[model samples]
Target chain A: MKFLCTRCDEVMKLAGAQAGDDTVGLTFSCPKCGGSFAMLTNPAETTLVKGLGVQVGGRSEPAPLMEVIQSSVARDTENQITWDPGAETRLANVPPFARPMARKAIERFAESKGIRTITAAVMDEARALM
Target chain B: MRMYHEVAGDGGSDILGQVGKMMERLAGRLSLIKSVIAVASPKGGVGKSTVAAHLAASLARRGARVGALDADLYGSSLPRLLAPEFIGANATRGEEGLFPIAGVFGVRVMSLDYLTGYGARASVAWAGAGGSITRGPVEASALRELLADTQWGELDYLIVDTPPSVGRLGDLTALVPSLAGVVLVSAPTLLAYQVTLKSIERVRALGVPLLGLVENMRGFTCDLCGAANRINVEGEMGETLSIMGVPALGALPYDQRLLKPAGEAGPIEAVERIADALLAKIGGHAAARA
Candidate 1:
């Protein structure tokens, strides 16, 4: 998206930017007339830009791989499943690569059964189902 | 007063530059891989995923470092077929990026199922102000992120199993920097042949090499007699293949053993032959390019 300074009939350079709770303000200045203006983006527009995984004003550091997905996915706390010591020990036995997936499966199994806390029994039940 | 004029660049966002960086990351990661093959078919329920899973296993059985990427976001069945135990499992992150889970035959596997933790039945709905209208762009972004993020270490072959859509095939071609080739899958049906021909045209138009076609479920081999029973009027598909000038890699007969568990010796012999033919075709294609 480009900005044209109608008063000066010249292209506007991005001067600065500020990100708010649900909006983004981009300030631009005309090189010919030294005039400036601010463009504020709505929540939806801000989200669309965010989804592209790019920063408004160039990025200082390269964005990490899958940063957009990793940030947007549901957090573990949102699921509301806690694990007991025994279950945690069992989970530790899984290989590091598969551990996260195993943990998610166990928590999902426990949640489906209306169980708030995951124990060794729940882990076994999930294993049996698998 | 003069008239206003639009600028040439993105004003300063450099969204295009960022996207270029993303593609660079993907290319840098894929540089270590020797061949990137995509098993695609425009029509579904034709064993594209099955062929992909078995092909990866077969390639690995040949001692090649293989990685199977389940590009089917809507229905990622490669996880269930290759590593059922890893279903509902979340992808683990590392200092570099997300890790691809090691599945059967030591083939590295990555899919949206791992990232989303929704397993095989993930109903991926992208909500936006435009409702269902934004699904295409959303899906493209998700695929781009998946390709850019997963840390696939050194590999001999990375076989991508694409969903049953010509558009998805186009997306893969556009996303992957240097695709080795594409293996179009087709059943022994006239309908499949028609749609697959269109896919063949699309691939050619994109200038990606076609690695021949695998005729799956062409016939059934009788278990008791050890005799192959010919299914579908033979020569119909042959005529079509001849007309299209696409090589027939091999015909996979319908086997009951494939329905059995993964470890229990199911169709490896047939799949190995197909794998060999694919390698030879890829070699020839590379030679021709050279």
Candidate 2:
């Protein structure tokens, strides 16, 4: 696949998924003014899988965090949080503190990239459980 | 093989199983990029965002898949620095979410400013009341929401720009799993330098790696050769940095070319050289990955 750099208009071949995410580096310098620029060599958004974990059911479980991204998936994905509106009741059974953390984590999952808020929630939830 | 419903209608193990599946899917996306480095400083006017933008740009220039995210929720400066000229309210409107304004060079960019209608984080200040921004004390979830809403496509580096403070709070960065390091920007001013040290130690205490230190506006430069020597000054910036142990990335002598845009007028387009200098110190791939 070919990825066109938005900066230099340089067309570099997108190395295969197996080739590695570091292969495609950015080079942005305007040939005219020597104004160079660059961006990261992104990975195959569709084919790759990043690990995400969250505590659930009294045990820490791996959670699917930010998934389904494309050159197309922009910040708007938060609007589609897909919260099971009534899930609040199910969330009730969780401890008062874990409930909040769970709520926040779920909201984060619905809104941003994956697992951004887990470290804190996991700790807080672990503490609450204990 | 357990199927979970996206709707709240059902409960039981199905919910747990479904959540697991969902997290598994989301993890797939987060895995694409190994690190999201945020450069920050607590006191404003210390060039925190400037260091962040340039470092990110430099990394991108060096062949890394980088996404420059301005997370200084209240002080986002990347929108203007990266892609200015975008005046439409729906400028970031896209099927996915807010679209980062591509700069003179394309670095997949996004800022909280893009989500709310503004060029920087100031807009969100009024828009999101004290506790209503999203939910919880952890802002990373809101950041994640911002990330989920935007179309970042893909990036190797997501160099985040943050408010100079103690740390982050979302599921992604705010609550961080791990970090490559934290680039704390400071000046030679004792107060700034001390705070920078505190931030460095704090991040390390939290387990986040300290990439190194960047002393901005270290001193003045000679007019003729542009050498960064503190003119008529008693001590050098690097002299004090030695005892700190953290690698002094380099001292940015008050370069008019570099400081002008990031000053009262805000990020100017002529500071690419500053970006280059930062990238060089980041060590590129040559710096053995620990």
Q: Candidate 2 at B79: error in angstroms? A: 1.0
A1-130 per-residue lDDT for model 2 (tens digits): 2233345444333222232332334343444334544444343321121112122111234322222212112333333333232454455555632333454445444334443223444434434654
The CAPRI classification for model 1 reads as acceptable
Q: What is the DockQ of each candidate?
A: 0.36, 0.01
Winning candidate number (TM-score): 1
Q: Largest DockQ belongs to which candidate?
A: 1
| Model 2 vs truth, CA RMSD | 22.6
In Å, residue B172's CA in model 1 sits off its true spot by 1.0
In model 2, chain B matches the true chain B with a TM-score of: 0.72
Per-residue lDDT of model 1, residues B1-290, tens digit only: 33324346676878889888887888888787888899998899888898898888888877889998988877888887777767667676665668888787778888887776444554444433333443455667777778768888899999999999766788888887478888888888878877887777887887788888998888887779988877764346676677888888887889765654343474467887898999998888778877
Instruction: Please estimate how well model 1 matches the true structure, expressed as its whole-model Cα lDDT.
Output: 0.77
After superposing candidate 1, which stretches have Cα over 4 Å from the reference? A8-48, A70-130, B1-9, B224-227, B232-235, B260-267
* Candidate 2 wrong stretches, greater than 4 Å: A1-130, B1-26, B62-64, B87-98, B119-122, B126-138, B169-178, B222-241, B259-290
Among these predictions, the greatest lDDT belongs to 1
The TM-score each candidate achieves on chain A is 0.54, 0.23
